[model samples]
Target: MPTQPATAALFPGQGCSLEGVKPLVQRECPDLYELCLCLLDADPFERSGDSTRYTQPAIFLASIARWRGLVRRGVRAGAFAGHSLGELSALTAAGVFSEPDGLRLVALRGSLMAQADAGGDGTMMALLKGDMGQARVLAERFGVTVANDNSAGQTVLSGSGEALAASALAAREAGLRAVQLDVTGAFHSPAMRPAVEPFRRAVANVELGVASAPVFSGLTAEPFSNLAVELSEALCAPVRWRETTLALARLGVERFLDIGPDAVLAGLSRRNVPERAVVRAEELDVTA
Candidate 1:
């Protein structure tokens, strides 16, 4: 058996992009194009270049492909952590499901989340260095809501754009680092309640198996071998990413690998785990 890595492999969530990835797939692994197309059930490359539905699966395909390529080069992971949608990819890589099932779940997730967006014009903001206690107080004052309790120092607020903007300004005035996120809707907030039932029903229909490695839950900050119900709730739950990272670090994970397109999670991990070594596999140049 291959030796397990001392690090945890991290996968990024929604904001990761797939630009210029199709050409790489076509050039290096022509076989993947047809397989991915079949999974998408449409000509995503020809249609709207960067639709969320297309981007979601595209990121999954690219991330998993990178993982396979790395394994082909003899890299193996011992533990896994994925941000939001990346969790499914991490689960799939850890043998919780086959690629086809992972693709199906991604498709269902994208469609259901799109439906959730139609419920309201809500937005998300990342507030840095703000008092969680005071932020909650501010949210209550403005009728807004706390969406993501990400790290010890970071929390995300969600509400109508006007409301979010107002809250952000207030936070900034109060000396907090606040910035809006570029997302379709206020995900992980009560605003996504409209999508919960359909997404939950869809996930319950899938069969999830046990993972070979420890998969940390961003919602519960605990390890879960069961993927179905927990993953469904993660779609709209406050991502306890900071807690997850700290917990993983406590388990002697001194090295971290971020397997997704962007380095956001890796960067966040660097900030959160300054004592650890972090490697972003996808960001590295691929061998010919």
Candidate 2:
């Protein structure tokens, strides 16, 4: 008998684009593209670029299209994990919601997030060569929030522009690369609080159920059993990507497939769990 593959599908959140993905899953999985047309009146994969509103749905399609391709090739991962917006993709892939429904939810999510951006001077910055302790120290000192704990050496700080600028300066002074993200608002921070209620309201209209396959939650860094509250709380909670990936590794996931636009999560996994194999699903020769 063939050995079971100890693999997991990793989905990425925002700040990652799928401007020109390979193999062009659009021709195959037109459902996502059609939904993008319905929602934005444009092909997100083709024109989204870095706009937060368009990027959300585009990333979903980018990730889900690869997921559909994997399913066609009979590659079934033991578990699924997503980092933020990726969580919704995971939920959709696990069948918690229909593809169209998932796209709709992400569209509304993107809009609310855009509104939050226009509401104030929010921003996000990346801290290179910083660990949890150092990031927490900076967060406290600069009054910023840890938007994403991507890896041991990389953390994203989010909050008001002033705080982000100050935090970036501090990182540079400490011999760290501080790069401001292309995103508009301070996602995964208290600055996103305003977007939460509207988002919650939107999710309420959409029916959510338990996923058919186990999905690791970005909020709890564990398998998600509930959707309603976890998603609501996800708004202001930092993405625990490092711990979440480690949790999958502990669960015997020897390999990780980043089923999304960029190989970011795969790269993060390689660095965070160097012993594990990480690759983008689309790049894999699924035909073989």
Candidate 3:
């Protein structure tokens, strides 16, 4: 029989929707569910799910809950990676901290990012059918920042709304499709600099433990050498997700399990490693 491929667990960022994850969290991780309710003062998935203050914690809780379910099913991963805000979930799942700490950190991060973007004209847009080279050219021409290198063909730009709009026009003119993201601010760019120091302090206070499995940073595509520093710097640094995905592949990850509410990371994995197996949390029959 052919050998089963090695697996890596991936977590999604703010793009994840909380549509079907509430029940899973309630069922598999009631403590997390209750904690989220207490932290946010409401069920984020049921309340203002679009707000960063709610979305970040909601996704973190859902991802961790799914990770717990995977653990119960004996699903082991050789490594882990998360996109943007999902990095906290990855670290927690890797045993760097307790789930409660992760949840609290995520809540603070969301609140800080939201406040940083408050009353600002910052936003994000996706450049599709374009490579990093083209994205860089647009960024240079329009004074935007390459926020997310999501895949070979999809890169996200973040900056002032006017700058992003101009970049979007230029991308479309260059035959690439540009779509505006629903985020409230220019995340992963200079606009988030205001939140960096505060988040850094919060991360520093947390007691971090060595990870059970290597957790690659989306900011650098490397195993985390210093959690507090990297997590803080990641606020304004681009998410090098494409590089991180390739790094996992180079590390012999032939299967990717996206332990988040949505299959967004699984979709990105397919784009990065088409020959490899990609599975979403929803696909696993963990109910047994």
- The lDDT leader among the candidates is 3
lDDT per residue for candidate 3 within 125-185, as digits (tens), equals 9999999999999999999899999999899999999999889888989999999987888
> Which regions of candidate 3 fall more than 4 Å away from where they truly are?
1-4
In order of appearance, the predictions have TM-scores of 0.88, 0.93, 0.95
Lowest lDDT block of 10, candidate 3: 42-51
The candidate, 1 or 3, that scores higher on TM-score is 3
CA displacement after TM-score superposition, residue 47 of candidate 1 (Å): 6.4
- Per-residue error (Å), model 1, residue 129: 3.3
**Which 10-residue window in model 1 sums to the lowest lDDT?**
43-52
lDDT of each: 0.75, 0.82, 0.88
Clashing pairs in 3: none
Candidate 3, backbone clash total: 0
Off by over 4 Å in 1: 1-5, 26-51, 282-288
- Choose 2 or 3, whichever is better by lDDT: 3
Q: State model 2's lDDT.
A: 0.82
Q: What is the lDDT of residue 154 in candidate 2?
A: 92
What's the lDDT for residue 239 in model 1? 80
